[model samples]
Target: MVEIKVKRHEPALIVPENPTKNETLELSDIDDQQGVRVQGAVIMSFKRRSNSIKGEDDPAKVIKEALAKTLHYYYPFAGRVRETGHHRKLVVDCNGEGVLFIEADANVTLNDIQTQIIPPCPLLDDLLFDVPGSTGIIDCPLLLFQVTRLTCGGHILAIRFNHTMCDMLGFMQFLYAMVELSRGAHKPSVMPVWQREVLCARDPPKVTYTHHEYEKGGDKSHEVMNKDESNIIVPGGFLFGPEEIKAIRNHLPSHLQHSYSTFELLCACVWKCRVKALQPDPEDTVQVSMTVSVRENNIILLPSGYYGNSFVSPAITTKAKNLMMSENSLLYALKLVKQSRNRANEEYVRSMMDLMVMEGRPKYKDHLSWMATNLTRKGLEFVDFGWGKPVYSGVPRGTSLVSTFTRFKNGKGQDVIAVVLCLPNEVLLRFQNELGKFVGDFSPLISPTSKL
Candidate 1:
């Protein structure tokens, strides 16, 4: 067994004044769409400073001290979930569980925490981040802190947050404030903007959509869909190295008639590649859904700090068996994705909003669901809490039916895109092998022009 020094942070002292409860917002009055409820998850990594000289005190104690000081400035965070009569929000619960700390053995890796620890946590398993609890305030689903001793004689702290309450920008701001607190700083230059009223669903709401809209039928909803029973298969989530990502990008043709974004091009290529790798029936139709945010749709210009669950419209493209079997050009497939995205705009959103307002939610159907979103534009890299920059980040679990995409800044300063998908174990291995072949064959074509 690999022995390593380990330390744990004891729960903080709770004041009687604070109590755990749930916050409630009136969905009936505003838009009744279930998507209005926002839930967010973030993972941050921290490295220990090598030159720091502290006495013989336990390292866990030092880290807890740093966290305690940091929590003080963000005192509201220390409280538990509480519910008021109607309004649901985070209330100060003196007796709250506070933050959790687990010191893993040296053999434990970040992947272990993400896959093993995070998915099983009660808070995350319950999916309580969005639901209104008995407390008036929304509970911080599960704020996890995993400290691992790396082989290089340093430590890494991984923090994950639920997205219901905060966006990427808001979470980063809060993180920076925590860092300031750890440093014993009194004030952070950037204060948090707790403007929830602006993002709340409309009053006397014009639309009343429910979870039923995205379900196969009114019987089984998207939220309630059982992954084990559903035909929607997801492969294992894996991270790709720089060279691998470069090769995938190089597979796209440089001489295209219409210009296509990297995401659009790559998404198309990956979708087809995934289908081919799975050896799905050639007659089967594959549908690719891309999420389009309605923040700038002009219908509703959400305030800068608006942190509510906004609209995410899916743009879909379907390809038949013949097309999938006969299509060798990745660019051709990419055009389909590009066309689908360009077509879904303000008018499309308004029409959907009107339909949702008039008819409520729609039902999910049989289709191969795949999506890609750009996180690089969301300022994920800028989120530097006092512990330096995060070494790794991700949303560990939740949606297994659909594959999600995120882009991050790699060490080489290149945009590294990640695709998280789920599929059968055997299919997944085959997919990986196919990806390896595509990358190997494609890398040589782009190496001369590559920036890295």
Candidate 2:
């Protein structure tokens, strides 16, 4: 392992460039759900720039200033999160308290990191730097960012924020606004909105439809928090390039070849492979939880600027025997995946909010479940920070059974989807063998990139 270390300095707060809101804002029912109450982060690593204008050279200064200005419009991010009443719903105390900011220097350069900066990045903990007390949900900093300067003059930008404040897409909106300011734009193209009340439980809220993913208590499959001991877990990345995708399609009937999508295929294949590898009971329930967008139908229900947790995670399940069947198992899994995803319409969105309240706001459960969230189409790979686009952009920490999809390139210089998968060390090989039956050279676990 490469020895990469960072030396940190005192932390500070960056308030809005201009004070504006002082009233508290209630969090949307979706945002307040126990699944999203924790802290999460996104990482973007950039190489030194040769094109930056003077005064724009230091990333920390540029980003910090841009952040304060960006916060003026998105002030909720500059506030703290607190629960109200015995119900435990959350609200943003828009006290203009500012966000956490830190600057640091890394002993190694970007090149040194690129050598091993694949998904499940080894440098995540050191790069993000989770400060003390920052993780508390009450009155804690809603947003935190760290800019680490490398010996090569490049830097790594890491951001931590309370998920209750916003989901990944919502946070991306805030990020782009800051990037605009870094480019000296007078104002963000899209202003922020805080209409959490838009998603509040309806009067006399009723569940109407059952939420499988939010089912009350789980079974023994979820007994262990992390996936067994660390030594038994194998976290790695897999690329789904054109060849790999085509090979997968070969397994489907011609009539269904183009019916399924990349995202659907990914969930189906991973879930199936994982089930086969785990060798769970033949009748054991195996599920793939997908984060589907409610925003498509939510455009009318939710205004344009509303970006809080606007999606729903619908868990689709089948018997392990069904998924591991000798024939047509992939098709079976795809059907479930599609149906589950399609259920996240506007009505589903409203119903989910109502169900959470009815269930008294339950926390996240992981029994017999695997999470698959897609960021590939989000265009995060193209997010530029003036220094240039990052070679690596994502988070590597989460439940061992959870995976995220991001855009990446293959050895052929072609676009592909990179998925970060975590499996037991004993089953990883078995899992890959199962997946290989559907894919042809899905690229290597790590690809050579010179974005630096």
Candidate 3:
């Protein structure tokens, strides 16, 4: 492994070029209250231009200029988040205090980092801006940007935003706006709509459906963040080529053939593999929790540009013994995932809101729970800023959340998927063995032809 070296430049504060007078922006229930516990970040790497290209500004200058101009519209990114209201709801304090911007130079190229799949931590962790506390929502910078230049003329762009401000969809939309401005566009492709009042609870606050994601349990024992090397889980990156996806589809039960989508099938395979890798007691119940978007299925319907957290994670639980049933365990798991996914409708969304209001949202700290999220079809890879689309992009390995990312289009125009997994080091070997059965004789390969 090459010792990756980085040189840090002075950090500058970037405020919106045109500031909005001091004001507070109330967040939607789903956006503000739900995600106040975690931070959302994306790391994207870009290649430097050739010397033959004439009159190109410094990449940092280009990014900073465009960011400044775009911040006028997305000014909330330049703000700080603070708690307000009797129920302790979060609101963005639109004070014109700027966001932190960092510029650094690395001794290695993007390929060097990519070759290692996920760069070593302290090194990987060094690439992004840091926040003080990871759990509670407090007065913190709503946005942070770091641009590290590589010796090979490539650069890594890492952006971190408070999850209370927006969801993945919302975050990508903001990025798209900045990219468009950098490429000399006068206006953004999609305008933002921040009508948090639209998501306010109804007058009566009715609960029409049951939400399985939450339960009545009070246990706050002050669990410290696990940082011990012996306790650290080895992160693994897996690729599911079209061929592998096809094999899994073919293996679906005869009666259920052609009914499962690629995402469902992949989730089923991983959920079961993880259960087996953990080797929990046979009689214990294990659960898979998946997040789904409610923008499309909401009864009242959010606006086209409503950028907020409009998703929910509904969990499905099954006995470890039953989940690993030799004959049709995978099929059975897929069935449960599909059934729980079907609950992302309007009534369910309403019920989730009401339940949170009535029960005062409890932190779901189940040791046996695994979270799976789908970022596959989102237009993250398509975000280009003149240099070209990213060779690779995804989140870092700091959490147990399993995310499926962008499907790049190969020369043959085939969709290639990447699965990012973080598991206990002890269980990784068994997880790989389980995954290999589906991808037979294949290994993790990086295809950088094109990003979606």
Candidate 4:
């Protein structure tokens, strides 16, 4: 456990190179949901390059210039988000102020990273460098990023963004755009579009389907609502390669084998494992909330380049007792997870939008909830900057209570999915033991092959 050191420089605002429109943009309901209102971050580790410009000159200056040019086309990101109207609806104030950018140097290399590139990385505060008072939703930069040049010549990009502006896929669009500019592209291949109005509530507002994710909580214990901070919470990333995933899949009954997707199966596994780790009351009902995108294989059809939040989390609830039932418990949880996930159709999204407008944009804040988002195919790991595609790219760590599944290469060079979870330190051992039974060597082994 050698101490990691980072030398940082002054932070500055990077506005678009060419002044764009100074008008405001209204956000969609999916964008400003209370659950996602907080800051979201991603940490990328780029390996050292020999023939690239990013490898020759100062990586910070090169990326800084690229960021400014990239912001020109996607200028909304250079704006700040503020609450407006009676509902506290959020709108982007395109004032051309700029996004926050910082440059730093690290004394570590990419090979030094310890696994699956999950959250809870050491020296996170040093890597991301959150400037004072720069995190507020209103009158604050919509995005902030720090690029740390490592001793081995590689660079790491740690970025924090206002989630209300876009979802994971939308965020990657901006990253890829920046990458293109870093590599000398005049403009992004896919033009950035700003049509948040399309995903807003219907003309009169109508709740056609039930949106259970936002509904009030079920029967929860006292600790569930008012959590005790006495226990230390640890964020851990669990890798599930083809072999590990197959091990869990083999447990399903023959008839139900094909019924579950990889994301649903892993979520159910983690949901049950977490329940066991926490030792919740048997009568207490728990919920696993998963974010489903409405863009692909759904009813919503926005323009190809629209980069905003267009996803919803649909929660599945079941009693703790059922999850403790023998090997069949995984099967039961799998079914519930798959069923809840299928609700991401167009009607559900529209109904959710209407519900938000009709109910004044409510936040349920369910006590017994866990967020399981699928980042296995968000197209982040594939984008190449001047150096090359990142060894690991995705989120940094737990969002207090979140599980992100991302594409990863295990120690054996096998492509896999890493399911990252955050839990109380006391129960981490128990949680690991429970999951360890599924497959041998399930722990993440990339050696910071990444951290978000």
Candidate 5:
């Protein structure tokens, strides 16, 4: 593999000459008290046919033109990152490569693409990729595009973006635009709205209520509760095949009066197994932290299609040693998870938002270390980059135990959901071993002959 560093000229930091044509999107408002900006990547792969024809439309040229034209539709996206004193927005950076395209051999899979594409991009390497501490960007564009030929005679297009700019829904919109462009469409169905001021945090922001009370200074402040001591990280990340997941789900007895959602069940099982594999003391408390969207929260019902960091809630749950040892059932554990998630009310979300605004942007590390997010169903599959459809897509590393779940369409026209989790290396291996044992005992439940 050839490693090349292409140093392009830095663009002058100038706001676009035309105001009416440009849109302003805010990143600071959506972030939490800790400036630990969220980062994400979208992967889409296509199968190549040996008999396929390469036409007058050069793939690279088509992609460039498509991106340019699509940017005109989502014009706000083309703006470069800008920080002015305390305010920031997407401005025109004529010198920065706001969007980049890298070409690699077809043999690259999603994993290979992530490795090759992220290193060369300075923005990704320095600012976004697996950042250890929180240093949120008011406006940072680290979009990566990799086109690789596959050994199977097809090509793949992978796009990665910082989550601060857009959410799953907005990201899908951007992707759909790219797909439309790839198909030679001059315009997208809907143009992007980049009016950041319109969605700014409320004046004198009133939402300040926290579920968990914080005591300033003292031993309480330094306490690290509910930390996972697992040494093995699951391999193949946290993704589980449809059959494997289904089997695990079916293992849950239906006799329990209260049932749990598939998500709750799966998370509980993973946590339980990981804890067991790690052999943490029975007294060790295990907690699960997951993110929830705040766009619909009553304190701030963001306008429809408003993109930025509108998410706030990070719910967590802990189990005592006695309970974990006596009732080791997955169903019981899932019930606890369900109850914990239910604690995230409008007030909890609003409190975080208020803190973010009041703190005036605390350093990033002060926040990210304690939280783990589950982004399993962030609408990634719906994103079409115009290459038929993506076979698989997601971010595999960086955050602690971050997970993404997607439904895949198989040849038989059946939909199967897959869960991908990224855990520490040792934790992952323990998870795999536990999963192996679970699968050994529960294979029949997941087989085609078994009822779902």
Candidate 6:
């Protein structure tokens, strides 16, 4: 068992430089995120050094300053969420109450922690700023930050965001803006667009396409959380190099081999491998849901800087027997995944919004359901705060609902894509075996990118 010793809890509420006196910002319908409410954290590791200009270097101080400056533009994050219209509407009270910031010390070094590979849950959780017990999801602060100083002259910077506030892209856009401010840039390169009203449902709310991905009729009371831990879900990171990616692509049919991208192919492989590892009943059904950026597919074109939850939940479902019995299961799954991707067009996105407006946010649950999202090209690796770029940057396993795929360098500086998978312990072993067969002798546990 790993222990995280907390030195102190300092709630630093940095108000925006230019505050909005009294205003409430209504979130887009997409912000009504379906699924469980848990604080999601993104952890970034930076090494400490002395600065001649400042005499002493402190990441917390620099980050706080940068955050304050950046929050002036992205002030909605520095506010609190409040309910109106008898809990029908969720809005951000832009009172500039400020975000929660904490300062802590850890006894471990950068090397002591499992960052590049599968990180420890306790250590990762320790990096997250604690949410007050009295605070629930509906009324909690939208943003929180924590700066943890390691014993080896390295520090960990972790930020937690309410999923309802923004998607991964929006969250990173804000963080990147802060990095620019920290680098002495007066303004962000890209100014955020807060025209969430554009996403509001139309007067009539036309639903042209059928949204089969979401259930239509269901009793909300029957939707209870799955508390069973008999088949404990374990998250691990699996690396796939260029060769492995090429091999998976080669497995595709020559007739339409060039139609698929690396992400689609890898999604197919992981989906099939995970299903096979689970050893579900022959007649059981499985579903693989991947998040698609709605900004690219929305009927009303969103600005480049539109930072909100603009994503369509696209899922492909099939029978376990069909997948297990197929000679080329990966290819079969690839075809299905591609089909789902193709369907996430303008019509589908508009239809999804209409579906939510009509059906009232549906909750999907099933043991065979798996979710995946790609953040490989989100510029997370480019986050710099004067000390240097982060050796490791991304979210840890807080929920098994979604597995985020990102590319990071290895010890040898070789580029490898990491698939963060949270599965049963026994299934994890089998899943690694399947992944190894594809990526020639792939190590179940590999060293992270930074040895510097």
Q: What is the C-alpha RMSD of each candidate to the true structure, in Å?
A: 7.4, 2.8, 3.6, 2.8, 7.0, 3.3
Cα lDDT over the full model 3: 0.70
Candidate 6: tens digits of C-alpha lDDT, residues 1-452: 23447575667777887755568888877776455244566777876664423326677878889988998989888788776663255688888888888878887777777453233234665777565652465777777888887777778888888887788888889998998998889999999888887666555677877654565576342232245443576666666777678767666667766777778888888888888888888887678877788775554689878898887767777889877765764778888887777777777776766666676666654467777788887777668888777777766563555777776665677666767777667887888777666566444343333232
> What local distance difference test score does each model get?
0.47, 0.77, 0.70, 0.77, 0.48, 0.71
Question: Could you tell me every candidate's TM-score relative to the true structure?
Answer: 0.66, 0.91, 0.89, 0.92, 0.71, 0.88
How many steric overlaps are in each model, in order?
47, 0, 0, 14, 26, 0
Better-scoring candidate (lDDT), 1 or 3: 3
**lDDT, model 3, position 377:** 67
Clashes in predicted model 3: 0
* Residue 318 lDDT in candidate 6: 81
Among all candidates shown, the one with the greatest TM-score:
4
Badly placed stretches (over 4 Å) of model 1 are 1-41, 54-142, 149-153, 183-185, 197-213, 219-235, 238-246, 278-285, 293-300, 343-367, 382-387, 395-398, 406-415, 441-452
Q: After best superposition, candidate 3 residue 422: deviation in angstroms?
A: 2.3
Q: Write candidate 4's Cα lDDT for 2-33 as tens digits.
A: 45687888889999999899998898988876
Residue-wise C-alpha lDDT for candidate 1, range 199-252, written one tens digit per residue: 443334353222212433354433333454346544355444466656666766
lDDT of 3 by residue, 37-143 (tens): 57777777777775424435567778888889888888877878887754566788888787778888778877667544232223556687463442245676677
What's the residue-level lDDT of 374 in candidate 2? 83
Between prediction 3 and prediction 5, which has the larger lDDT? 3
How far out, in Å, is residue 282 in model 1? 4.9
Error (Å) of candidate 2 at residue 16 is: 1.5
Q: Is candidate 1 or candidate 5 better by lDDT?
A: 5
lDDT of 2 by residue, 56-108 (tens): 58889889899999999998888888888856888888899999999998888
Candidate 5 yields a Cα-based lDDT of 0.48
